[model samples]
Target: MEQLFSKALSVSVRCRDSEERKSTIRVTIDLQLSPSAVHKRNLHVRLTDDKDPYFLFTLSISEEDFQSLKAQQGLLIDFGSFPQKFIELLELCHSEQEAESPRFLLQLCSQGPTPEGPSSLSVVETNAFKHLNHLSLRLSPGSDREVKDYLASCLARLKEEREALELRLKRTEEDLSRQLSCTQQTLCEKSKELEKLRSEWTSQTSSLSSRYSDELQSEREKALELQRRLQEQADQLRQELESAHRSSSQQLRSRVGELEVSCRELTERKYKNESAIRDLRMKLVAAEEEGQRSKQQVLSLRRDNSLLDSQVHEKERALSQLQMRAAVLEQEIKDKELLMSRTKDVLEATQQQKVSLEENAVGKDAQIKKLEATVKSLSEELLKANNIIQKLQTEVKSLVGKIKVKNTVTVSQEKVLQETTEKLQSAEKELHSSRQQLGTKEQQMCALKEQLESTVQKLNESREVLKTNENVISWLNKQLNERQMTRATAPEPAAAAAAATSGAKSPLYPLGRATLPPVGGALSSPADLRPTTQLDVAALDSKYFERVDSIPIYGLTSHLPKEIPRPAKASLPSAYFSA
Candidate 1:
């Protein structure tokens, strides 16, 4: 077996001795193994086929009637069955080393007839090796399937264990929370009992204090009334005794009157002292009532303060619970943050690995992108080339349209560039001129700067002038308004003044011409004259004087101008001279 294993010896044998023996063969074995040590002629193996090679096979042995056939295997292989055995061997292979190295297997299988004698095992092995090449591929279906099922079972068991642990933790937490709630309810019942006790105690204390205060007040009132009654009795006795003493002393003793007067004075002082005592007792009663009210109020405040303190304690406990909850929440947040950090790190690592892989492929990708760009450029070039070819072929319409657009664009660009260049040149020249202008402007600016002070002085002078003019206008407006107000108040006096000036001389006047005389010798002044057009005052001496000759007279005095025309010389009415 050792020499055969070293050379990968193959052999085949066919059944020829007994047809029934070959027909009875139902199991086959073809293995691939490498020999560890081939020195032992009679080997003791712990596993079946340990001396041979382990290979896949189909054994038609009944479990109820099986012999220990594996230990005493001998050469009885059929070459026709060898193919089925070799493929079964390949499928049953468990190790990579066993499958990769094509080790020869001993044929410890069913007996088969052969042409040669017992020495024909070598030929059988050779035929078996050649035939096994065909059937080796059939091993694929069954051999590797078992390991997958086994691994799946192991993973399922592990997952079940984790789920059970999670369920247990959840149950524990629920139990703890239930216990905490029961504790809190018991505490609440206890606090309620304490509050009831305090309420009963405080109520009894307040009632007792109020009753004591009332009893004390009644006693004080009774004492004050009795003292007042006694004072009234003593004053009556003193008055009666003084009347008796006075009557007796009038008859017998005038010196005893002084003694009686002094006793009356003493009684009066005692009455005043008793009244003061009564007032002090009343004040004490008032103070006791006020103090009792304060005591009751203090007791009420203390009870309220206790309730508030208990409420504050409850609030503090609630705050502590909230703080604990907050701490838990913070811990949860931290856990979430830690999980996120780990996840982020994992994600970043994955991304970095992806980036590294991408970087590893970057040259290829760049090449592909470049190829794609080159392909696009080539395609574009091809299109351009095609267009040029079309142009060469005199497809001028499309080219002309493109050329027209390009020409327009070029023209506009050229115009814009030319305009910009011209503007730049003009700006440069303007800059030079402006530089020169700046020097001239500097001199003018200095002159203007000096003139600015004088301008300020002039502006100040004008402002003063404007102020003065405003004051003058204000004064004049006041006078004018006053005059208008007086005229409006006495328009009849103005008319009367005008009439008197027309007919009579004024004594309190400044000018002589402003008034007319009572006699008709002098002509009326302009004040009395009727206005026609503008008066030719400078040119007139006699036109007005000559017109006066025609006036009509009233009792030999003319009121109108004296040159009164004779109207048809009817007899004069006597009414004309009645004045």
Candidate 2:
């Protein structure tokens, strides 16, 4: 069956009069079977060309015209045959002379205003009002009081919206200011850090230059000392050679004089006596033979002296070579000393870096341990929360099962579940936050581990360098001992060799002490040779404890519910007691 219907369109109307530029008026239309029925249906058709700020007017038409217009879809009505007000509205909406677009819109609404009150109507009825009614217009304009009330309500709503927008704008401004201040503080801190780094760099450069100059001066001094010692040794050797030459010449002169005297005596004896010629001749022959023997002995002595002179010349050449070798060894020792000094400086720098890294590691370990404790606590809380949730669920199920028998208990259980749910939510939030914190700390630990590995690599490199230097120094010491043995006589050379060994031991003592601690737990140094500082042991112990404390373990019963429910009353006790 076809159903009776009404339709209405509410439109904000703008009209330009001769004096006024533009005026806004609210217009509503209703189309139905009768005027009385339109009022009864609260179908007010409000339209006005009045000068007031607000107005309401009603227009009602017959059912025949409504049906005819409804069949035509009502979008393009024949305003040529309609009322004057309707024609005026259409003209105002489609005026060609108006430069500006229409400032009004049409809203299709289901219900219209009535004399008694506002009434709700079906969409079919409203559509009928718009589409199929005859032109029998009956208008009821709203009183000035009603119009003033509507305007007042609209103004109040606008004021409230304006205040709310202002409040939001102020909050945004505050947030921006807070962020700006935070950025400014961070920038200032960065600038300060930059300046501090620049100053440290300048100081380091200056110290490096001074150390180089000092090393150069020490090397020069060692060279000059070596040269002076070589010169003294050369002068003493030349003097010893000259003295030996003078003594040999004197001995040869004395022997020659003695031989001349012997020859003279023999000549005198031969000339003085001829009477005892035969016996004297025999004695003289014996004396001449003895003299010849003595001369031969003297010649042998001269040959031995010449051999000694050759031996002395060879010793002098050996001494000169030894002196040259000693000079070379001294130069090498100086170089080794310089290298050792540089190694010591590097070792000290590495030690400081190691100490700092250890300290940072210790701090991180402590933080990790603290986070672990917090995580443990959070886990406990979560377990407790979960246990509570389980209890609540069981209790709620029990309560729901007996809800018809015990509404009061059900109500109480509901409240308990609500509280438990809130607590569970809070616990979960804490767990999430703890998980985030753990992730961040783990990242820090990984970064620290990387830093520690890098430091260990640097330390290993330094240790190898120091070890190589020590070996070179020891070799140089051995070379020095060899040179000393060649240059100095037997007892003196022995003493010098002992002294060289002692000198070699001295530098190694400090080098071993300095390099040992940084290479802890590594077999770089023998157990006996490692530094025996109390502080180092204490620091190691502390680091070990920190590591051990960072990790945590849980027990199976840690999350168990604290309370157990009691057994219910006996089922057959009442009947048994009665029997």
Q: What is candidate 1's local distance difference test score?
A: 0.49
Instruction: Name the 10 consecutive residues with the lowest summed lDDT in model 2.
Output: 544-553
RMSD of each: 70.2, 72.3
lDDT tens readout by residue for model 1, 301-381? 999999999999999999999999999999999899899989988998998899888878968887888899878856764
User: lDDT, candidate 1, residue 404?
Assistant: 56
Tens digits of lDDT, candidate 2, 353-446: 9999998998899899999998996787678667866876786666567665544356776776677678667767876786688789989999
Residue 125 C-alpha lDDT in model 1:
17
> Which number leads on TM-score?
2
In order, the Cα lDDT scores of the candidates are 0.49, 0.55
Residue 401 lDDT (model 1): 57
Model 1 misplacement above 4 A: 1-267, 279-283, 286-290, 320-324, 327-331, 337-579
TM-score for each model:
0.14, 0.18
